[model samples]
Target: MDTDAYTTMRFERRGQILTVFFRDPAEANTSDLAIHEEVGRLFHDLREEREARAIVLTGSGPAFFTGLKDPVGSLLWQREQGLPVIDAGRQVARRIVWDLLDVEIPLVAALNGDATGLGATIALFCDAIFMADTATVADPHVRIGVVAGDGGAAIWPMVMGPALAKRYLLTGDPVTASEAAHLGLVTHVCPVGEVLPAATAFARRLAAGAPLAVRYTKMAVNRLLKDTMAGAIEQGLAHELLTFTSEDMVEALTAARDGRTPAFHGR
Candidate 1:
């Protein structure tokens, strides 16, 4: 695992493939400001590598990603610093996903374990995602005391049906591996030990395919997601930014820190 001060994430390049891993062990592979910037940089670098035909992302410890934790405080901290607080993490994350969506290279997610919040979004943005049978995927934003923003609001409904999306996103519940595959949320669901190898093998196939044809084809499908999801992402991200200053978020954070359930007054 390659480490950097700027990136809490790690990067490893093997022949024509680049693998990025979310390495935060505590808080379940959570991301902070530095981590966000590093992800952006990593994508930028990946784009510049002429030999890089594919990219695979996963987590180091127990998750593919766990999502952003301090939705309100993260936004509020920027305000306190007298900087514009407009979904900094969300915006960065959106750009990261967009890079995966728009890049000419193939993108894959090897979901070795649990992925939640932003983590779920990262996995969803990939052109293909491989999940281990032991892993779980969730967007626990609402239950954890926040709006289901990030990429969940934008991407979940597009993959899964509206009814199932509504239940999971709103309730902040998880989808099991079998259920995820049945719903077409993941491209491949393998035994716990096979996820990485399966993902790499799949990516290698794409790596050997006609590069221009594959890239263009991937771009075409991504545009479908962009056209369908851009609006929802815009609207949801806006609302999430507003929640930073809203009283409900404050109460929610307080309750979370105190280890209790929040009673949102809907301020």
Candidate 2:
């Protein structure tokens, strides 16, 4: 496969296992507007790689992946520049995640460090998620006055059940690797250095397994996830975007920038 074609993500292949490291050497993996566009198309492109029977998806750097580069700045820039917030926000939260769910191949996520917001959502979508012993996961959309529309609403319930999902989503609290494993949210939790190797071994095993059986088994199980996404994503994204124009969102962003607690008026 031509790894150079993807700028935001680095792709490498070893035998039948295709590893997609989230970003290049210079920058940490961030779910900014740029990476949002890259992820939307990567899975579709990977489907054509006949040699790739299984894929390992991981981030390069200290942090596995965090939320947007600057949620406050991005929204403010859109407003200042007279760009459409709803359209752009929906593209990242709804469309990109929707496309990632359609990838047929088995995906292994090696979480080397913290994963927040959309980063957590991306990890949750993978077939097998192995977190570093110290890694943590959280989706803090509510913290910034936005709905968890980026696959959080769809996938969280399936993995952790509705009650636990609601608690985490409502509070926007961090779930440590131990807590995640305890809650049955991740496949395994290993030392930071062991995460990649363990994930690679799992991917290689899947790659060497029966191709048709493996693919079809994954497809069969993901139907539930697909159905849930189809039902919730559109409405969730629409509501999230609507929140973007609210006084609370403005207050949240301003407070974040200025380093103060926002006193929301519930507008």
Candidate 3:
């Protein structure tokens, strides 16, 4: 695709797989308006391409993704573009998380490095993930003063037990890639720079399998989780939506920008 138009992501094709990459090396591939739009467009392309059998999602420069777009920067964009802050964030989430998860083809996360908040959630949408052994992953949404609106809310407990899930989800703690592989959150922990190649190997294996059998198997498995997750996705996303307009969200962003602690008064 023509990457000239996007400032935050790039779309590339490798054999039968579609690669959607997050850009923003200076900020650890942080989420932003441009990345969100490109993610949606990439998925749409994958859905439209009959020959594409899988997706390899990765970060362009490094560090997977830091997290959500800067709320302060986003608010500025909201005013500059004459848009509502709530609507803009929601739109970004819908494209990056909700829309991305709806992809039917096998999805793979190539963790170039650490992933956090929306970054980690993006990886969670994938059917499989391969991470650099040295990389780490974390939810950290709660620490940022918002609930996770991405697939993490629904699938986290399924990967790890509900007990551990609550611990990590509530605390916004970081977990290493090796630990994640051991806990079933990721499939493999590759050498520091082998994440993309490993993911490609796995996807190529799936691509080599009988298409019908693979698709049916994936559908059955995901359907089972869909039943188990139940209302997790909706409830978590609702929590995030309600938080955006709150004084706490403002306080949280200020704390992030100012390099200080936040004391939310439940407003």
Candidate 4:
């Protein structure tokens, strides 16, 4: 597959198995606007690749993928452009997460390290998720004064149950790899160095399976997820965007930038 157009991810094909690595390893695969846009678009390219039967999703360096890169920078850019960037971001999420769910082929996630916010949401969409023993998973949207609209509200309750999903989403707490496995949030957990190998092996097994059967099965099973996403995506995204302009959100962002605790007054 020709992946030269992907600026935020590295794509490699090994026979019928494709592995996509999030870029900027040195920065812990922190995503910015360009990366978010790429996430919204990459699946179209993947769908066109007839040779790829399965996919492995992962990030490099110490983290699987952090939430956002330079929140303050993004806020400033939004201010300068007179646009609600947060709303724009949620729209991208709606497109990308839905596209990921619609992918007919099996997909695996190799969580090399911590995955937060959008990263966690993406990981949860995979057919199977394998994490490094030392890694963690979280959707810290509430921590930044936003709703978990990306795929959190749509997928988490299905995978982890509504109570656990509500707890984590409400508190913005991190789930350790072992904890995730215990809670059935991940397919497998291995040592940090073994994550990629295990994920690749799993992907290859799926690639070697009955291709049409695998594709059709994935399509059938994802119906629930698709319905859930469709039902909640619009309202959740709208509410999340509303939070972006709240006094609490501004205070939270400022506190994050200053490395201090924010005092949210529910303004």
Candidate 2 residue-wise lDDT, 1-267, digit = tens: 466767777878898889988763336354456666666667667666677888998888776777456678877665565437557767756656755666777889999988888789889988999999999999888887778877787788888889999999988999999999999889999999999999999999998889999988898877777876677777777777777777787888899999999888888
> Alpha-carbon error at 11 in model 4, in Å?
1.2
How high is the CA lDDT of each candidate model?
0.77, 0.80, 0.73, 0.82
Mark the 10 consecutive residues where model 4 has the least summed lDDT. Answer: 75-84
Output the lDDT of residue 175, model 2. 96
lDDT by residue for model 3 over 1-267, one digit each (tens)?
354556566677778777777775466354565555565566555554566577787887658876445656764444445436666666666555544545567888999888877778778767898899888899877775777766677778878888988889988888997689888888888997788888888888887778778777877776776667648876776777776666776777778789999998987
Please list the residue runs of candidate 2 whose C-alpha ends up more than 4 Å from where it truly belongs after superposition. Answer: 24-31, 81-85
Model 1 segments more than 4 A misplaced: 1-6, 25-31, 67-83
Error of 3 at 135 (Å): 1.0
lDDT for model 3 comes to 0.73
Model 1, position 21, has a per-residue lDDT of 79
lDDT score of residue 179 within candidate 3: 84
User: For model 2, what is the alpha-carbon lDDT of residue 9?
Assistant: 75
Model 4: residue 95 alpha-carbon error in angstroms: 0.3
Instruction: State the weakest 10-residue window (summed lDDT) of model 1.
Output: 1-10
Which residues of candidate 3, in runs, are more than 4 Å off?
Answer: 1-7, 25-31, 67-71, 75-84, 95-98
Which whole-number lDDT from 0 to 100 does residue 80 have in model 4?
Answer: 48
**Candidate order by decreasing TM-score:** 4, 2, 1, 3
lDDT score for residue 214 of model 2: 91
Q: Which stretches of candidate 4 lie over 4 Å from their true place?
A: 25-31
27-115: candidate 4 lDDT, tens digit per residue: 63444677778888876666666888889989965788774568666754654454456567767878878778778888899999999
